[model samples]
Target: MGIKNRLKIMSFLQYFIWGSWLVTLGSYMINTLGFTGIEVGMVYSTKGIAAVIMPSLIGIVADKWIPANRLYIILHLICAGALYYAASVSDPTIMFWVLLVNAMAFMPTIALSNTISYTCLEKNNFDTVTSFPPIRVFGTIGFILAMWAISLFRFELSNMQLYIAAGASLVLALYSLTMPLVPTAKKKKNQNWVSMLGLDAFVLFKKPQMALFFVFAMLLGAVLQITNTFGNPFLHDFASNPAYTDSFVVKYPSILLSVSQIAEVAFILAIPFFLKKFGIKKVMLISMLAWTLRFGLFAFGDPSPFGFVLLMLSMIVYGCAFDFFNISGSIYIEKEVSSDIRASAQGLFMTMVNGVGAYVGSIASGKVVDYFTVDGMKDWQTIWLLFAAYAMLLGILFFFTFRYKHEPEKLANVGVKH
Candidate 1:
């Protein structure tokens, strides 16, 4: 098989592992294992905690000691074991620790997979900018397919999702041995610990505009986490109502939630046009407003015919809410930062968003969810409206606080090059 095809398969399976459990696990924990919102949030927070520390440490190991492909294999192997053990865990505290081990093993593999892919592409003389996106899109497809598989097979509320993830992780680990070997970088005497750990990127905080952008990036990251952590459980809650018990939304919430992933693929194609026309500030503001709409629609949505329309709209807007800030923010960082710290800056962006932002969001959103629960029944409408209001407030603040002039010609080149 061609290298591109091989890498596509790798990308697919890499995310397939995550897709198996990420969306549905909340429902499983809540509905089957009888865990509370705070407990589930604490479990999910493992990903945030792992994202903060593991990637940088793992990057150092891959750069100086282990080949990226080899490290990827090792991480997936650990993930397979951790996830398999997680399936057998029933106690919330035990499950938290089990999933934390899994998260630590799994989170770094994301960056390692990218590193492996980039190395393979460059060695084969492929243009990473042009070639990588198509290959990466398969990962999203893998995610959607996994969600559908869990829902269709009635594994959404079972431990089978974790087993499936564990099996996939094992397969990917074995398959990774076949990929082209990525060589480690030789240690440089001049490299400082701050540079190695990506702490040098913190210098961007000195610039007021960049500092404000990072802050908002972290806030938006929290929104993303809130959706991921609760969206499935929210839809699954509809099954409690006899009137909506037979509806497709209740019968297969993950499949319906997969629409958000499908929409994500479509919206990514629209980003260049939006960025070119509106610039980063306006594009980001649109993202914030889309997030507001996403939550507000969910606030009113249900399994009823008309309410179902609102549910579908929420799914559609998720693509805009997600990709606009994430991809656009990366581009903004690329354009603004110097070449020396560019890579570090990107790493810091992820740390702020996925690490700190996700941790805070998970914990805070969990508390919010619990606050609205009485007699074991949740006030989902009020919960969603409060989230919507938060997004709207962020939009308002971001509009006034962030200042950047749009230069069409400068960004035009970035669009053309990508």
Candidate 2:
């Protein structure tokens, strides 16, 4: 297959694994397994926990011993097995470890997928900056398809959902064996084992601007997981109430939430325009500010169409809030870094937000939700309001603490240095 065809298949299967679970796992956790808030948090935070070490570890293996394609296959095969084990297991704590292993393999693949595609593109002298986004955006389409499947098929409540992810992963794992081999980077004779493995991205801390950006990346990452980890269960919590049981929000929550993906598709086009118009710093601040509204709007919105309107609008804003920072930040990293460490820098970036931030936020949010929603009362309003406040506080602090002067012409293309 051509690079384009390979990327198309990779994008489809790459997100298929995640789409099987991410949106509806909250509902499954709350309504099915009957796990406690902390346990649920820990389980959901598997992605975060794995984020800390998995990508970097895999980066080393890919660089030194194995080709990226081979490591990619290994990760997915491991993920498939672990996810299947999770489906068979009953204990939440055990499932934590199971899912943790799943995440350990799965999360790194996000970075690895990029590496594979970028490698192929670079070989053909294709521009990663422009070519990659349009191709990669299809991953979001896969994600949307997975969500719709989960809801339409009533897989959210099934233990078999994990199996669905595993099956897709199994397909991806096998498919990878047939894909073009991404050559492993040859190690330098004097390269420190750690540095060769991409640990050098850690030295980004030596620069104050770099340090500030990462810290804020972790903070913003906290907001990113809030909706994914809890919003479904929070909205579905109303189903437990007699009055809202028949509501559209409760009946078709995944479909309702899928609007965010639709919004994401539309907003991605606006990012270049926004970046040029407002610059990265302001665009991100706009995102954080929007997140503040996101949670707060949910806290007050009801099960009725009017309330559901607020929920829908929040989903719409989610595109702007999420895509702007993630893609723009990735581009910013590409712009600011040396060409050599750029891939590792991207990996570390994912590690911070999807990794460390995810772990902390999911567990913390769970504990808070458990505390407020005690005695059979699901105090989702209070829970959302707290998150809104957190977003607001982070936005305020980020505005004063991080300083970057954007040059519009510089923002237009990737790999262009000022």
Candidate 3:
């Protein structure tokens, strides 16, 4: 097979494995396994924790010691083992640790997938800017297909989802081995250990705006895993409400949530326009406003078709909520920072958003849920409202802190960032 075909298959499988369970795991945890909010949050946060530290480390090793393709295969193999073990678990405590192991192996691969793609495309002399997003969108398509497969196969609420994930992961792992090898090019003779490690991204914290951007990035990062933790189960919970059982939203919860991924693709296409017109700060403010609406919509949505529509709108808004801030802000940082530290700065943002931000959101949300528990009922509305309020407050803060005015010439000159 040609390199492009190999990469396309690998990309498809990368997200297909994740989509098999990512959107529906909360439902499985709560509706099937009866795990509480905290446990569910922790399960989701494992992704964040993995997102925090591993991507950069893996990137460094890929840039230094190991070939990206080789590392990618190794991580997937490790992930396969942990995922199989996780699927067989009956206990939450053991499940947490097992999930953590799977998370570490899998999380870094997301970024690594990007690295591999860029390297392959560059090696083959393809224009990444014009060509890559279309290819990347296939990953989202694969993700949606996997979600449908899991739900349709009735694997959504079972350990079978993990089996599905493991199968896809193994395919990805094995397929990755056949892809063109991306060997680390020695950058400089006797590279400094710290420089080689890409630890320099930490220096971005010195700038006041960088610090604030990351702080809010972490704060908003709280929202990152919330839907993944409760969204499907939230709709499934309507099954208990009688009025919502026959509802399309309840019956087709995964499809309802899949709209978010659909919206993500749309939002991504709109980004260049939005960035050119509004600048990153305003665009991020838009993200905060969009997020405030996302959770708030869920608090009031139902399981019926109309409810599903409302949920779909919530999903549609998710594109703006996610793509605007994360992708756009990274580009903004890339425009401002030097190339040598650029990779590290991107890693730092991921650490803040996925790591510290995710940790805070999960732990805090868990506490909020536990506190709201009374007589075996969770105050779901209150929890969502609190989140919405927090996002609103964050929007207000970001508006004041991040100062930028759109200059078309400058934006046109702006380069591609991670």
The number of the candidate with the highest TM-score is 2
Candidate 2 residues lying further than 4 Å off, grouped into runs, are 26-38, 189-198, 408-418
| Tens-digit per-residue lDDT, 106-158, candidate 2 | 88888788777767776776755556666677788889999888888888878
User: Where is model 3 poorest over a 10-residue stretch in terms of lDDT?
Assistant: 409-418
TM-scores of the candidates are: 0.85, 0.90, 0.86
Error of 3 at 376 (Å): 2.8
Least accurate stretch of 10 residues (summed lDDT) in model 1? 409-418
User: What's the ranking of the predictions by TM-score, best on top?
Assistant: 2, 3, 1
Which should have the higher TM-score, number 1 or number 2? 2
lDDT of 3 by residue, 176-276 (tens): 87788876655777767766665656656777777777788888888876656666656766777877668777678778778888787777667777777
What lDDT score goes with residue 68 in model 1? 79
Task: Kindly list the per-residue Cα lDDT of model 1 for residues 95-183, writing each as its tens digit.
Answer: 99999999888887876776676667767867544455567677878998998888889997899999999999999999999999888
